[model samples]
Target: MAMAIRYERPYSHSAHWARRLAWVGLVVFLAAALSHRFGPLTTPHFLVLAGSGAALSALAVVLSGIGFIRLWRVGARGGRAAFVALLLAALPLGVAGYAAYAYFTRPMIYDVTTDPFASPPWLKVPVAHQDFLARPPVTLQDREIQATAYPELTGRRYEGALDRVLEGVRKVADEQGIVFTGEAGLENVISDLEDLAVKPDGDTGGESAITVVPVPSARPLEEGFLPRIGGPSDVLLQGEWRSLVFGFRFDVSIRLREEEETALVDMRVASRYGPHDLGLGAAFAERYLKALDAQLLGIAGN
Candidate 1:
């Protein structure tokens, strides 16, 4: 009698869904990231969710990698899923790593002021009962940094009458969408001094036409990274580039002092908190000055 040949059935790979699990983890992480960026939840809550999701996704990636290697050895399936999952996992990982690097490498100061020598004073009266963020006093170190980083930020001189110079400043600020504060309007009050037989274009002790603009508030984010959003952000990076929450605000000011046939316009932008401005102050001043220069040229032509 001949014995029948016996063939054992091949076994399926254990944890074949490892890669699928990684995919799910990645999805969770992406959702968390979106929520952190655009969702109405506060910073702390967003950080927690993001941190948890990243951890889970990372673990899943590791497990999926191991599973893929094992499956290959065993001649099992799911090679494609494993590879795709690994690739997907890397996207957020790379982003997080880059953000960490940028955060760590960011400037030490959070406040940016245009006039480092004599920064225009910020006067936001504290709201009653509600704690208000106050503008940071300019420090020597901050001035030094501003001077070094923004050498071209010095005031520019223009030859024009007081009203004309003031109009130029106003137009520039308006174009930039900066609203003038009451203090800035006080320049109009001092415009009477122009009639003292004093030259409005000379530096013969004529009051400056000032324009104060409170920086616009940031919109509720729809989706984006921290640095990509509004200036003077409440999110601050501290030790090891960790998050330090501090609600803050920013404002910009233009002071145009009249001298004989010349007006010296100085711009100052500052945050209510932090010492480093991420170089935003310098950028704002540069743009404003350029716009003012163009506006004055237009006026001269007219």
Candidate 2:
């Protein structure tokens, strides 16, 4: 007897999403081409560009998964060739096509880190599904410190990005401190940390007060498809943010820009949602602030 091959069809939901992602991904590819054909995506809006592309890639992934399930269930008798092509090329094509645009367009051009800094690869898998495996990081009082401007990132444009956010956080902490502990600022900082960690993307997780956007906010000169069509997973990162309320754990991503260089400072203590963690997101942030301050001290050597 010939070895039997299994034929499986995709579930309804999976097939639906897969079809949707394929269409969306194709549109993104075309927009990228048009952008390159005309003028590349410009500054003050690069983050939005990048965030959109990243999100589209994610949607493509969702679609591909759906299609694969369909193929597995239905068998390749009807669409085997198309299924195989998409399954193999889905992510690679997305990565290669978009990466090429990113290299040339560089929409995330924040002018922060000229020198290379370390960053792990992409989440590599679903953040929600992955096990924390450890406790989250936290910080204590008297540890928080301020960050300095990078030498390469000049001009007021970059600084303007964080000014409002920094001021709002600082002011709330100060006000809360007068009535609570003189350490109100620390509490406020922790509260903000909580917001970042817990809130999910608007579509799936529901919208919160916080959302990420480009620096030096501006309305583009003309309309474009990719920018016009926003999708889920626009959120680059988030945390549990319990440090502000119940004193849970958290972490934050710090971007540095001075002159023309942009650098990222990601401070973590323990692990978030991990079994062993002390759940101290604020405390870790406090520690990061201190470490940043120390780095500044060494660089300025004062």
Candidate 3:
């Protein structure tokens, strides 16, 4: 038996584009809603921000409603459907608008609380931590970032050739009163600078990459091991060199708090380099981390 087939050409290109637009708007809406729910749901700032978002959403919908009334005046039969879709699209507009407001309005005078381990799910593992994780992720500019390309960015801070990073770390541990400081754990270090690329230029550009090494590990996070999206990532090793390069990109950030609390955030560096740049990247990373880690260790100890 042959199956009957029917073809309808009722859907126009304009409608197709409209549907695509609706989907895009929906994605934006969902993302904004999730961020609002997860990022700052309980704070007073969040409430204020959400209120503004709701108001903006109402405004956009109201504008569309006015347009709908105008369409009805023109004798369009289904102005109602247009109004619904238009209002829905404007939902995300409110989200984006309010988020912008939150960006400029939130108070920067945050107080850090010391509740101990408020560890997120991504930070947990079935096995006990052989060592603390490498430095936690960071939010640089507007995005979460990590130093995975050069060792210097992620490694121990050094004052100069006379300074050893390990010694510096110990000194800081004593200063901060970090009592649990036997071997916090090892960090993944890197040596290549070429693989790190950002958006607006190559496959990714508008971003710059460099690495540092030798920083202590911090607590883990509640994120999943998502597949790399291609940027800069590091893998640690137990060889003459401490870190290895197994991936292209990594996202990292510092833990956020309402106040200034003691937080230990570790960092790492890694990369795949060419024949000529092995020393180039490693040396740069080492130098960078030496100085940077020195600053951090000072903080940790203090």
lDDT for every model?
A: 0.52, 0.33, 0.33
lDDT of 2 by residue, 175-261 (tens): 322111111112222112332233545646545444332233121222333221111211112222323322322333232221222
* Higher-ranked by TM-score: 1 or 3: 1
Error of 2 at 79 (Å): 5.5
Question: Estimated TM-score per prediction?
Answer: 0.53, 0.24, 0.23
The total of clashing pairs for model 2 equals 46
- Which candidate model has the greater lDDT, 1 or 2? 1
| Number of the top-ranking candidate, with lDDT as the measure | 1
All-Cα superposition RMSD per candidate: 12.7, 22.8, 22.0
RMSD of 1: 12.7
Query: Tens-digit lDDT track for model 3 on 1-302?
Result: 99999863232332233334444555544554555445433223333444554544545455455445655555433354445546566666654565457445432211111111221111211121212222222223111111222212331212221113334434543443222211212332322223222234353533544323323443344255542221122121111112222111111111111111222333322222211222222343344334445564443221
Model 1, 105-218: lDDT tens digits are 555555444445455444442221212322354587877876776777676666555566676777777776566653443333233333323334655555644322211112
Give the lDDT of residue 107 in candidate 2. 22
Residue 39 in model 3: lDDT: 47
- Residue 283, model 1: lDDT of 66
